[model samples]
Target: MKAVRTVAMLALCVLNADVPLNAADAAAVFPDGAKLELLWSDGEFTEGVASSPQGDIYFSDIAGKTPGRILKFDPKTKTTTVHCADSKKSNGLTFDLQGRLIACCGAAGGIQSVCEVLDSGELKPLVSEFEGKRLNAPNDLDIHPRGWIYFSDPRYGGPEPIEIDHLSVYRFDPRTGDVVRVTRDITKPNGVALSPDASTLYVAETDNGFPEVPGAGSGGGKVHMTLNAFPVDRHGNLGERRILKDFGKETGVDGLTVDSEGRIFAAVRAESRFGIGVYDSTGRELAFLKTPEVPTNCGFGRGDDGSTLYITAGKSLYRIPTESRGWFLTGQTVP
Candidate 1:
């Protein structure tokens, strides 16, 4: 009997040793069947993933309360690096038509500011104030091919430490250096994305009423929740705001991306059954792609013949092949 037990224990040890350590299983917040391939994993929570022309992925690490940085992932080599530190609490990122990196930066007095990364990797502030008032906390941003940038200014991270005013979405024109407030109704607007044709802009309505999550947050709790979609105009102005959908108490929406087919993909919050929620062009829930972790954002990675879908959840980055590819590299003239 003792010998049999000993042999069984040895066999179990051997099996455990042979099995490869997978962080996906450890960090998964829900069930995932999309054949998740781990691109990178970190202890810091990641958000706002964007792909460059060369197919490299860039994301922000919002883990540290004081210090935040942007990380880059190289698909070919399967390696990740700290692309930039001291991002001034930058949360969202995207590349403009000219291939310049656009960031939504936050600081005590620099709330909802727009900045650009030069070729030499220098941060230059573009828009800091709108209408002579400090912009709120600019969370996530998306750029249209027509040199117009639309960013969400939720009070997620801002100075003055007040949450009384309304959260808004703003548009910045690269040519005229003009800034316009597109919408002022959203509560805690986050993660912004534009349609492939640049006619529509989507923003995540994370209206967790200030202070945040009661005991979960210091004073910020009550999430006044909803999602919104706005029409995009040529002069960097928004036409009309529309309700996309509403979320439950436990779940909210963040960082969004649109495919070449104009399908919107949003990262679902805590109570979401699926980490990533897929929506049709008409604001319908088409399908939900279960990710390994609680996805904060997603991006389309250009492959040789097709493209790959990259999702950034908790501490890991996941990828899966998609039937329809994104148009970031197809030279499609965007509005």
Candidate 2:
């Protein structure tokens, strides 16, 4: 694998790092003179960035003709290596409480489910079909503290026929091996994230007017792009959703991560302002860090590098030092 290094000149605009302005909150999320450093830029479509327990960065490269690859970046060695060569088009990845790597691996002609990627690079399928029918495509996911896996299922474009009617979010219980449809209210859900305390579930509704149909040029009707907050119950159920931020006619968020304070760091794809948008849990914009390309996903490192934020955009991976640390349910246990 090849790696590239470039300094990303950032346009920083930070208001409040946290809700209440303390001595620490007074400091901007991006430290003074902070900039994005390009780590690698040789992917087809980079997505699903997650920091391992060892502080190593892992992201997916969704290929066009070949199977997706999960690449790992070591901050100490400063090298990029292939973690999984045949990822089955894995999109979103996270580590469970037991320090196991869980991934949403289902794209066009892909695995079509959320599975656990073992140390031997083998996939252990957790859930493939929701009911009796196969899922459209597992896109992104976040695990709850209680071991429930919440993921998004939406088909953007593919030659295969759509099995499920609605593009929705589903939650799978690994203990019981049961899958439950969390909600199908969104037009097309792209990213799914849980709050630090597991009280709120943030879902990014990025509808880009489905793929090309035989008769119609662009099939799926109206496009609704927005970031929503859904209240999550103790039983892993979702309540009425509240539209947090509406992008109107522009492309919305792709993937997002929450900090320890529950602040959302979203990969906004708005053509007018493409970058990472940091917002409070109540939908208030807190900061914005512009990227060289349209970002797909973002995650924060752990341990000594906990303040560094890793971003995946276009075909490149970028990182910047931030004042905030990522919130992980599993603590800092290494697998």
Candidate 3:
């Protein structure tokens, strides 16, 4: 019996050695060699992360078919709680200057809307339909310094429209609940973020429907990947479009965010290598943070004093220490 027990222990140790490291584990490899320790991973793919003023992380669970939910993660306790369930398949999320939770909901037709949960737990829909025409599902969003809210509405999920042109970007007036169409040129705008100065708006164009490339198959045929930079106005009017970066291999860019220094961190699934594509202010790929799960979105928030990179990947949330500060700022004022 003792010999059998010893053999069992040896087998267990060997199995543990073969297990792969998680996201939290990978995060610890940052500057101080600190990897992310899983806060709570129930095998549900958590996508699109946002932070509250109090330093809690909110993420969307988009893995399940029906019953999707938005969850909140408290860094202090390392506990995750369900914030809101039966969400409209909420994908990307952010908070406005007023600290109201803003989410991009899909499957509600070409009608992109913004909802803010009031203190009474009531969700107030700010903008639902755009230009009398429904918006093509809002994918991701970011807020500007001047209180204007910008979002991406790409109709890539549902069946292709047999009629309308398809997909556009929108800006919402938080004060008056008005929505405006800023641009309608990108083939599929997936991730959207603003520069530090709020002068440039970056949108990631990823090809969702395409042929499978033989030998070099990342997921599809050829990823017509590109990032666009747009000039914006205080009133949320975008102008002057220019190509920032183009990754022609179809490693489809998904959700993204910018740091305070104007660097873009985009989540890209490239040939089974799911990670982030780091771009400098001048639109150059600086470095890549590889991950085990396919990351959907990421954002910057302060933890342990300096800024930390919080990433949302398949069924888990992770964070790593960074040299820069948080992108989400307070009363310091930025224009």
Candidate that would win on lDDT: 2
TM-score of 2: 0.90
Q: Which stretches of candidate 3 lie above 4 Å from their native place?
A: 1-34, 108-112, 119-122, 159-164, 210-223, 303-306, 329-335
After TM-score superposition, what is the CA distance of residue 238 in candidate 3 from its true location, in Å?
2.3
The sequence of per-residue lDDT tens digits that candidate 1 reaches over residues 1-335 is 01101011100010122224343421231233335677666537777788887777888777656557677777776677777766767778888877777888765444347888665555788898777777666788887777677888766544454432556777788778888777766656788888877777888877766644222222356655566778876665777778887776766787888777787777877563646666776666655565656788888876562357777888767776555566573444444
RMSD of each: 10.0, 4.3, 8.7
Deviation of model 1 at 13, angstroms:
29
How do these models rank on TM-score, best leading?
2, 1, 3
TM-score versus the correct structure, for each prediction:
0.80, 0.90, 0.80
Worst 10 residues of 3 by lDDT: 1-10
The top-ranked prediction according to TM-score is 2
Q: Residues 113-199, candidate 2: write the lDDT tens digits.
A: 898988878788888897787887799999887888899988886677776767789988898988998886787888988888888
lDDT (CA) per prediction: 0.68, 0.84, 0.67
